[model samples]
Target chain A: MINNEVTKLLNMTYPVIQAPMAGGVTTSELVAAVADNGGLGMMGAGYMTSSQIREQIREIQQLTEGPFGINLFVPNEFHVSEQEVELASNRLQPIREQLDLQQKEQVDIPNFDKVSESFQQQIEVVIEEKIPFCSFTFGIPSKEIIEELKQHHIILIGTATTVKEAVENEKAGMDMVVVQGCEAGGHRGNFLSGDQESLIGLMALIPQVVDNVSIPVIAAGGIMDGRGLMAALCLGAQCVQMGTAFLNCEESGAHASHKEAILHAAEDETVLTRSFSGKWARGLKNDYINEMHEDESLFPAFPVQNKLSQDIRKAAAAQNKTAFMSLWSGQSPRLAKKQCVESLMEHIISETRKIGRKV
Target chain B: MINNEVTKLLNMTYPVIQAPMAGGVTTSELVAAVADNGGLGMMGAGYMTSSQIREQIREIQQLTEGPFGINLFVPNEFHVSEQEVELASNRLQPIREQLDLQQKEQVDIPNFDKVSESFQQQIEVVIEEKIPFCSFTFGIPSKEIIEELKQHHIILIGTATTVKEAVENEKAGMDMVVVQGCEAGGHRGNFLSGDQESLIGLMALIPQVVDNVSIPVIAAGGIMDGRGLMAALCLGAQCVQMGTAFLNCEESGAHASHKEAILHAAEDETVLTRSFSGKWARGLKNDYINEMHEDESLFPAFPVQNKLSQDIRKAAAAQNKTAFMSLWSGQSPRLAKKQCVESLMEHIISETRKIGRKV
Candidate 1:
């Protein structure tokens, strides 16, 4: 039997959650589509400003009265001195030359102050709007912030890469923890402090997380179908969240080329790289990633590097050259079906039902 | 406690098996090492003849009294008419020009009759020697042959890619079924009749096969450590078989370059291609595979293409050029440790124990 906390929190017949894919792929229409089809839809407010987040929430609220979630990127503000930026920039000189850009240009460093602004503003908006469900990635938020949010009756969910991280999330006052495997696309929610990152994939990560944490776990990464959903549930996850599968739906705001790439991708084509942004993320292999990998020294710090590559990425997307665009997708992107969001959700539910019946 | 049938059938303290990584990587020494460590070590017979298989089995037998298994590839004998070969040859003319080869060279189709001859002689040896376990890949053998092997008290293990294939293996009297997921390296075990090739990964495939078939299932592909081992056990698998992890052990016969490549590989570096042998197989991305993908017409039929590339592969290996070799490995190759086989097995057991303690 399903746990009552999850049942009440998700407001869904099945404990299936659509992962909030930020930066234009997940739209109000997509979220509402899943919500209307009896699964929790998530609005990704990771990159959006407070005003934009509020507007998007209003749009989703108008479409569906059922419960939904909004995902945030818990910012990490590590200071990078100018000397560090210059050193990293010098390493990227070859790439600049390849792009016909002038060398000796001043290296830009991102202001960590922006993180505090984003978090404070987003939290205020969430409190005012009384958003029922909220989830965070990258790292867990402050204990006080979580306490304040919980005071407003908001359910707090945290994302984790390792079992230790999952346990930490539960201890940090999160109502549930999301076990994000290395197979997951986009920025890695690696909160585990270490010399080198430990990547525990979904199959190995889930059961351990379930066993270690006292809280409910929402399994994410590489879950694309009913079989995956059922397997996650059987592995002791209270729910499953999928991003890549939902990214290809018609209601999604992903670019046409991005959708096309997802539809035609093979199983092993996706790769995880820190080239796209300063932090590690998974996406389809492209010339930009290949070039960055070849000239690793030239890349700058995280948010700054991401900002610098914005123009080239925009130009590539406009030109329909997928070879340069960031095609973020998970390992099971090939299993994604290009159907209406509602129909896809229905298919998932039906498949899960079939599996349950057999069991 | 572990199942009695698996222990009795495999002649091991535990039912866990190490996959045979043939083509010299899986050495007699490595097989003996695993058997000595109390796990069933398999010798890959994919590229070997009856004589080579006999020699390897004898070598392993001489080193360890514990049980081991032999893997055979069911020849894909779909006949391409002479005209088809001529047409394929004509299409490959440009590739010949690119290589500066003479234009009108004769193309010889490899004799696939050797597949049956090899298997027949190998079966006689297995029966005479009372080999404890034998597994088939690519597809299952005939019912009469499987029955004959079962009569001799030899365990018959059949590999399957889908639920339908697992059901078929069960009906054909296989003692157990190995669920090979898309995460598996080397040639895909897709039969000609099953046109629908579902790329369900290990996590999704293992449980589905367990639920669909009554026979005990062994999970293969992408499992490198004890965490993977425990997860498979929790998902209802009786045992786990790993290939890539064992490919880098001191006892393995893999070339230095190949071993180094596997050790240096990232989780996302592997890809599946049919360019190597005209059959879909997974390997590390290299110049030869990348070039062939860019020039698809150069690829011919199975054994013919495999034979034609032999000289180039051998030349590349002799010169220690990695770009031309087939570096077949799973996604978890990066996690592979360069240690002795017994120490590696002990490490895996200790890791599993650590995870078990945490749980």
Candidate 2:
């Protein structure tokens, strides 16, 4: 059951793929550990600079000789007004005071031209480093970039939150697509559909996507253990991409407090908020999310809002105050466990076999 | 895989339960067809009076000798101020005018005591009719009622939207619990968690609920075919209760426009709205939903708001105008087929066997 088109294409023993969660969650050690354990491990290059991406690829190559992947964020054109930024800054004033941090003026808002240029450089690095696999989030890359990647024999994967998005990815020549369900953590990958419409559950998402596209479908979201893996496969997905399950692993770069918050969180404790970043992401409910519930829509978009909250998140982490930090988690946090990659992979495989036999 | 504890308990050969959809969708012919085809059929007796329930039970008995179930809405104490009802009526005036419905002199608002009395009478009818299986939505019944039903050898089921609600049902002596996911159509059965918190997807809701409770879990939400059944089973559900799948059946009493809307809908076309009944329900986005979006939160609770919009919906249905009627559907409308219950059952069973043999 574990051996199929996905395994053959990715050249892995198991059909598990570690989700590339940005903001320092996917460490090279974590990626390498999963690769060594017969699963595809992906480095989250969405927020990394070209230099950082190159260095991590080298570091992972030394840790494991197995094939690994990298994921990049396709930059979307966004508008940010100065007055809106000021209003957002004023709203964060109380949180800064609570963190006892000095108020800094002139936050560096990201420029779209610079972001797009950086993405190009990141793609070049993937080709230069000869990474076996590369996945994209937010949107699909241009025809030229995809052709360039394919020229270098890099298998490209696209992230989608709807069947139309999946069809678009297939038309754009993606080798596979990860269908992110509403139960997923981190950022939502809805490009064509609105936030509310893109929230199709895995139970409905996988089959619909598979029926529309010829490429192998990878299901991502609140999948934690064997039950999720088997269910995804039964729903027509060829593989499963997990984020929260791997984020709690020992080798992950996630903060201790962030890990603990998920470890103790209930299924209903997580809520989707664009407060941390302009794009809606699922995370544990805290004081910051509650405070920004009303004003989240008024804040700047994506990289801009993410940059504005950097200092507060850093300070909160330094002080170990989880309330001010983004504690990202999927809906199935109650099933999360703090373990190593090898053990998690072993458990998923064994339990999947057990269920397959029993059913 | 089809034969399990749930099937044994329900005295059915297949692990399929036709969702007890209210509002005349679950006709006697439809229920009898499902029962005769190896699945457990259920009557949506939530809105039926004592005499209506008795008549339906007798009607279904004449159609099929197989066992079937009935679902009741547990009455909750509600307060309806005259001002609020008037305000709600004023808000709905434009829709009523659009539908050309005449304004009545006095709107008969439901009272809590009378609703409770009606529920008691309904329960007495179920007992007298010797219904083999009974289920409750919104909340659990009283302990004395459970004891009385058990003494009569009737199997009890409870609907839940979260893990805590499932545990409560088990504690209340429910023989089984149906975990309704966010992808489910119709009214949400969230008694303990808020609307937002209770919207856990089936991918996250099923396994978490299964891990917490000892009773059998029947997965519900966006399930339309054999793939959904196998996926739900893999997620630890002993059976699956489907609504939208059965709502479009040939024998179902749904309006022709309702069936056509679902048959032609896309996966992302449905959305959750409270304008129809003052309770959150997933359905196709139409004129009524779009117009009432801004004022849905201000509408009176359940039966009160449900009463306020009755005339408009009835007129729309009579005229075959889907824009004003509630075309309830799940996320996977693309998978729905306008077939008879017997053909649908045979397709599901064959697909399940094929998937089982392949996997």
Identify the leading candidate in terms of lDDT: 2
TM-score of each: 0.61, 0.99
True contacts kept of each: 0.04, 0.75
Q: List DockQ for all candidates.
A: 0.06, 0.83
Each candidate structure's count of clashing pairs = 3, 0
Error of 2 at A315 (Å): 0.7
Candidate 1 lDDT by residue in tens digits, B1-359: 24456766788866568887767877888898899997889988777877777787888888988778888776667565677566556654544454444664564567668667777777777777677888988888877788889899888889887777888989888889888776676767766323223444576467657777898898887777776776566556788888877888888888889989988875556777776677777788887777777655446667666766655566678878888788887756656788887887887777766644433
The global Cα lDDT (0 to 1) of model 2 is 0.93
Model 2, C-alpha of A280: deviation from truth (Å): 0.4
Share of the reference A-B contacts seen in candidate 1: 0.04
Most accurate candidate by TM-score: 2
Cα RMSD (Å) between model 2 and the true structure?
A: 0.8
- Restricted to chain B, the TM-score per model reads 0.91, 0.99
Inter-residue clash pairs, candidate 2: none
Q: For model 2, what is the error of residue A191's alpha carbon versus the real structure, in angstroms, after optimal superposition?
A: 0.8
- Model 2 scores a TM of 0.99
For candidate 1, write residues A1-359 as lDDT tens digits. 23345766768877778898878877899888888887888988887889999998999999988778899988777666676666666655554555555664453455778777788899889989989889998888888899899999998999987666887898899999888866677777886643123344566456657667899999887777776766566555778888888888899888888889978875456766777667778788777778787645455556766766665566667777787778998766657678888888888777765644544
